[model samples]
Target: MSRIGKHPVPVPQGVQVQLAGQTLTAKGPKGELKLTIVEDLDVTLADGKITVKPRQVTRRARSMWGMQRTLVNNLVKGVKDGYSEELEINGVGLRAAMQGKNLQLNMGFSHEVIYPIPAGIEIKVEKPTSIKISGADKQLVGKVAADIRSVKPPEPYKGKGIKYASETILRKEGKKK
Candidate 1:
């Protein structure tokens, strides 16, 4: 038995969880999130808890068991408290700002980069070099943050560009004369 698959997800107060067909939906104060269960796994909701079990004792079924359980867990957590990612901009003139619903990034590029915010996602520029991305969907929030970070990935030489708030850049030695 998979460790994570056997663990039951507990539904918190003010949160509702429902299973219709293969789709699981969670509604809460933050927002609503839904996830489709993959084949070879069974998901059941009972008494304010969700449990996952493999349909068969096979390699594929075992592999997907833990993954499916985690997906369900994420849905519950997302609807309950939501998710957020923060990015830090480095460099002399590098900065981030919100222009309407889009994000304007000045990362030493010849032209400013404009990143359009997706639905259900919020982007806030708290400071000139700090950016916060929040959303109910964990995957979507992470993807958006990765896309933004890819725009100006930190370089090893100068260690300048966009990086996660908790990320550490390895500084490279400069060339000797």
Candidate 2:
């Protein structure tokens, strides 16, 4: 049995959740999101709560039950409050800025790297070293952040590169002469 799947997801006020066949749609003040549930699970919405259950007593159904439930929950929360991730740039001469609508990054590269902002996603640069990525779709927000971070992932030696604000890099001892 999946612990998370057993719990019902409560729908908050100002949010609407709908289920049609294997598809689920959630609309809220922030935005709207849709997801196609796996066939092994069944989802129903009633009394402002969404419940997910396995369609059969098989291993496959049980395996997908909890994951499907979480997907639905994420859709609801994403439409209602959205998701965000923060990135921090480290190293000398490493910084970020907005060039019109695109993100301009200077991470010790000979050429400045420019990333075009995607639709429905917002990027805000507070300080040159800090960046905030937000969007209603949790997956997209996280993907964009990962794309940006991949440009110059933090090196273990000096911890110099782009990294998540909450991430901690382990330091390795350098060569002993």
Candidate 3:
């Protein structure tokens, strides 16, 4: 009864899917992604679509079935449409900037933090407070944004932290005098 697993994945043009033994390899214009097939979780390719049907829904299978299908779908879409994440810095004097492909961050530290951008991904800092990340791989783009935000996770007090632009943070007030 998993909504995600029940959904069918459409086979897009220029993308190749190969089911070899217990492994699935998806190749697209962007890149190739591979995953090991879980036992008893059947994936069938029919009529330009992929379907998932688990023989028995155990606790493990129930939890993983939906995730696996979602990952596969993302891979297919990533190769075609790509992905992006935006980050914002909130604080006085705490900002982020791009020095070429490296990110320069000033987050309450005496020295500026430098983060190098990975290949196949592009980072653009609109200002000291806004950063945009774009890449063909959805997972890669999300992971990079997470790593950058982890550098200065939003503080509960004063809400000074690096967070996704669309994220909302709970602000904690200062202690009473």
RMSD per model, one decimal: 0.9, 1.2, 2.5
Q: What are the lDDT figures for the candidates, one per model?
A: 0.91, 0.93, 0.85
TM-score of each: 0.97, 0.95, 0.81
RMSD of 3: 2.5
Reference-based lDDT, residue 47, model 3: 88
The window of 10 residues in a row where model 3 has the poorest summed lDDT is 28-37
Clashing pairs in 1: none
Each model's backbone clash number? 0, 0, 0
Tens digits of lDDT, candidate 3, 97-163: 8788798899989899999999889898888799999887788899999999999899887778898
lDDT tens string, model 2, 135-159? Answer: 9998899999999999999999999
Clashing pairs in 2: none
Prediction 3 TM-score vs. true: 0.81
For model 2, the run of ten residues with the poorest summed lDDT:
67-76
Candidate 1 steric clashes = 0
Sorting all predicted structures by lDDT, with the top scorer first, yields 2, 1, 3
